[model samples]
Target: MKRTPKTLLVLALVVVVGMAFRVSWNALRDVARAIGADHTAATLYPFVVDGLMALALVATLVLTADARRFALRVLGTYTGASLVLNYVHGLVPALHGASVDWGRLADWNPANWALVLLATSLPVGSIYFGSDLVAKVLHHQPTPAANAEKTVESVSNRSMADQGEPTPEPRVVNAVPIPRPVQVGFLKPTLPLKPMPAIEPVPARPASTVAADSVRTRRATGRVPDVARSTRPKRTPGELLQEARAASADWPDAHLTADRIRKTVHTSAEKARGLRDALIAERAA
Candidate 1:
C-alpha cells in the first residue's frame, strides 16, 4: 500500500484500540467496585460503565454495513441487558435514600469520564456513517427529474452535432507530367546567311533594239510560244525580301526558318533564307 493509505489505516486502528481500552478500563473498574475491591475514590454505579459499552456496541453495529446477523443478535442482547442493569441500579439507590442523591450516584470518576466519552461516540459515528449510508441508498435509487434532464441534454447535443457543418473531403489529383524543355546552343545562328550567286554585267540594249527583236521573234513564231507563256514571273531580290519581311514581321528571329519564309513569301528556299537574313539584319539595325 502507498504511504498515505497505510498511515490512515494505522491511525484508524489506533483509534479503535484506544476506544476499546477505554471501555475495558471503565468496565473493569466498575466490576472491581461492585465486588468491594477497588481502592479509588470514584463512586459511579456499575451500570453506567456497562451502559456506555452498550451504546458503543450499538454505534458499531449501526456504522457497519455488512455485519453478520448472528453478531447483531449478540450485540442486541448485550445492549438490552446493559439497559436493564442501568435502570435497576438507579432504582435500588433511590429506594434506599427515599429521596435519590443524584450527585453522589453520578459522580465524575476517571472511568466514568471515559465512559461518558464512549457513550458520545454513537452520535458522532451516526452523523458520519449514517449520512454516508443514506447517500448510498439515494444514489442507487435514481430520480425521474435527473433522468429527464439527462435525456434532454443528450438530445440537444446530438442535434447540435448533426447541425454542425460537414468537413469537405480532400481532393486527390494526378500530378501533370512537365515536358522536358529543349536545350538551346548559345553560338547557334538565329538567321542563316545564304550564298549569293555571282552577278555578270550585261551590255545595255537600246529600247528600239529590244522592241525590234521582240517584233521579229513574234513574227517568226506567228504568236507567243507555249514555252514562253508557261515560264514563271521572275521577282527581284528587293521584292522577295519585302514580301518575306511582311509575312514574318510578327515572327521572332529564331523562328523565321527557310521553309516558313518560302511558304509565306512564295519564293525558292535559298532566296527565302536570304530574305529572312535580310529581315533579321534590318530589325537589328
Candidate 2:
C-alpha cells in the first residue's frame, strides 16, 4: 500500500502513544510499589489504573451524547489519579527504594494521611468507575431480541390499522402468532343465475373462400391484412433475389446491408441475407 499523508500521521500517532503508555506504565508500577503494594500486586496495579484509563479513552471515542460525557469524566478521573501517583513517586525519592526518612509521614499529619488515602482508594475507584462506564455503554446498545420484538409490534400495528381493526394491547411475552389451519367455506348463490341462451354453431366454409372473406373483413375493420390471406401473389425466393439485385444495382455497397435488402425486396431476413451476399460476390467477380 502507498503511504499517504493520513497513513503516515496515524503511524506516527501509534508510535507516540505506545512510547507514552510505556513511560506511564513504568511510573505507575513504581508508584504502586511505593503505596505498599506487594510484588504481584504492584505488577498488576499498573494494569488496573492504566487499563481503566485505556478503556475510558476507547469508550469516549465509541460513545456519544450523555454516554460520551460519562466516559470523558471517567478518563479524566483516571488520568488525574495516575498523574498524582506519578508526581508523588517523583517528589518522594524515598519511594524509589532509596535510603530516606519515613519518619516525616509517620507523625500522622492529616495532609500525609490524605495522600496515603488517595493512593489506596485509586484502585477501588478504578473498579467502581470502570464497571459503571461499561454498564452505561451496554445500556445504550439495544439487544437483537429487543429490536426483533419492536419490529414485530410495529408490523402488527401497521397491519391492524390497514385492515381497519381495533389495535390490540401489546403483549408482555413474545407474541409471534402460531400458524393455524383456516377453514374456508364457500357460500351457495341465494338466487340462481339466468339460463344462458344456446349459441349457434358456426358453419365451416371452404378454405379459399374463408381466406378471401378474412382479407375483406380485415380491410373493412381498418386492420392490416394477414400475409397469408392478402390478395398480393407470393413471390418465390429466386424472384425475390432477382428483384433485390435490380433494385440495389445503382445503390452503394454500404447501403447493400441485409436490413436494407430485406426492406427493398420485402422478403424474409434469411432470404435478404442470401441475396445481399450474392450481390456482393457478383460485384467482386
Candidate 3:
C-alpha cells in the first residue's frame, strides 16, 4: 500500500517500540526458562529483537544527504530486519527447520508484525516522497512576458496574402457558336487576355546627387540655434521659466508647486523696485 510521511513515522514508531518489547519478551523467555517457566508450544519463539529494532529505526529516516546519518540508518535497518526475520524463523521453527511443530502454531507475533512492517516500509515512503520532491524541483516555468509578447507579434504579423495572391480559376472559353456536345470538338477556343508590357530596369541618375549628399555629410553647419535663447527679451524671465519648465517637465511625475510660479508682471515690478533702491543708495554714497 502507498504510505505517506505521517503513516511512515507512525509505523516506524510502532515497529521500533514493538521490536524493543519483543527483545524484552525474549529476555523474559530466557529468564522464564532459567526459572523453568513453561513456554511449551508448537515451536520456539524467535529472539531477534535487537536486529528488528535497528532495522525499524534505519527505515524511519534515510532521505537526508548526511552520509553519517544514512550509514546509521542503513545499519539500523539491516539489524532490525535480521531480528524480524530471525524471530519469524524462531517462532515458526517448523517453517525453517526439518520437523513440524507437534502442537498448534500461533500465526505470528504482534510485536514482530510491527517491526517487519516498519523495516521494509521506510524505503517505499522515501521513494514516494522523493519522487514528488524531484518533480517539483525540476518543474518548468511558463514563457516570460517578453517571450510571450514576441510570439504574439510574430503570430499576428503572418498573412496568407503577404506570402502570395490566391490562385485564380482557370478560364475555358469555347467558340460562341458551339452549343452541342459532339460539335464542340470542331470549335476553336478563344482566350481573352491583355498582353503584358515588357519591363526595363531604370538607369542610374547622374552622380551630382551623390556629391551633394557627401557635401552635406562632410560640411558641418554653424552651431544650431539655441531654442533656450529668447528673441523676445521684453517678455520677462518668469514667463519664459514657466514655459521652459512646462516643456522640460515631460516625464510621468513632473509637477510644480502653485505658490512658486508668479506671473512675469510681479517679477518685473520687483526688478523695478530693486533698481530704484540701488539708485537711492548710489545718491547717498
Candidate 4:
C-alpha cells in the first residue's frame, strides 16, 4: 500500500502512545502494589486502567454523535484516574520500592481510605465501562439488512453492465400538424339585372380620331383607365364544411378547438365553433 501522510501520522501516534503506556504501566502497577494488592492483582492492574483508556479513545474516534460523547466521557474518566494514580505513586516514595508501614495509616485516615477505595474500585469500573463502550460501538455499525440491500443493488448494476444492455428510452407521442389559414375571395351582387335598351349603330371612327381620343384621355387623367376584373364565385356552406372536414381529418380530438379550426378553414368564428363541436361529437359517438 502507498504510505500516505495520514498513515505516517497514525504510525507516529502509535509509537508515542506505546512508549507512554509502557512508562505509565510500571507506575500504575507499583501504585496497586503499594495499596495492598497481591502480586497477581498488581500485574493486571495497569491493563484495567490504561487498556480501558485506549479502548475508549478508539471508540471515541470510531463512533458518532451521542456514542462519541459517551466514549469521550469514558476516555476522560480513565485518563484522570490514571493521572491521579501515577501522581500518587510519584509523591509517595515508599510506593517505588521501600517497604511501607500500612498499620500506621489506620482505617480512620481519610487519605488512606480514599487511596484504598480508588485502587479497589478500578477493576469493577473497568468491567462496566468497557462492556458499555463496546456495546455502543457495535450498535452504531451498519445493520445486516442495509448491507444486503446495498450488495444486491451493486450486483444488479454489475450484471446489467456485463450483459451490455442499453438503457430504455422514454416514449414520445407524435405531434399534430397545425393547418394555416386559406384565403378565399367572393363577389357580391349590388344590383338587380335589367333589360338592355335598343341602340342605333354609329359609323366606324377613323384611326386618327381614336388615337386623338386616347391621347386626350391620358392627358386629362395622367394615366390609362384600368379594366374591370371579374369576381370569384362564393362557396356554399356545404362546400366550406367539406373543406374544413378534409383539412382537419388527421387532427387529434383535443386539437379541434374553435380558434384553430377557424384559422385552418378560413371561416368565421361562429362557423368554426359549430364545426368543432360537430367534429368532437362525431368522434365521441
- Cα lDDT tens digits, model 1, 1-285, are 899999999899879967864654454344334333334522343334444444445445443344324334444654554454344345445423334332222345674444344443433443554454444444443347878999888777786567587689999999999999877665686788689999999999999998998888443547887877947678899888877778888888789788899988788888877877788789889
**Candidate 2 Cα errors over 4 Å, as ranges:** 1-4, 98-108, 142-285
C-alpha RMSD of each candidate structure in angstroms: 33.3, 15.3, 18.6, 28.7
What tens-digit string does per-residue lDDT give for candidate 2 at 1-285? 667988999899989978887877776766666557777987888789888998998888777788899899989988888888777667766766733343232235785777667768888988898998888877776447878999888777775557586679987897799899765456666887689999999998999997898787443556566874767689987888789889998999888899999888787899888999999999999
Q: State the weakest 10-residue window (summed lDDT) of model 3.
A: 41-50
- Say which candidate scores most in lDDT: 4
Clashing pairs in 4: none
Q: For candidate 4, give the lDDT of residue 274.
A: 88
What is the lDDT of every predicted structure here? 0.57, 0.79, 0.48, 0.82
| Model 3: CA > 4 A from native | 1-47, 63-191, 204-259, 262-285
Q: Which whole-number lDDT from 0 to 100 does residue 215 have in model 4?
A: 83
Clashing pairs in 1: none
Query: Tens-digit lDDT track for model 3 on 91-180?
Result: 654533434333222345575456445434534544553344344334524437779899888867989766577689999988588565
Among these predictions, the greatest TM-score belongs to 4
Candidate 4 segments whose C-alpha is farther than 4 A from its true place: 103-108, 142-285
> Of the pair 3 and 4, which is ahead by TM-score?
4
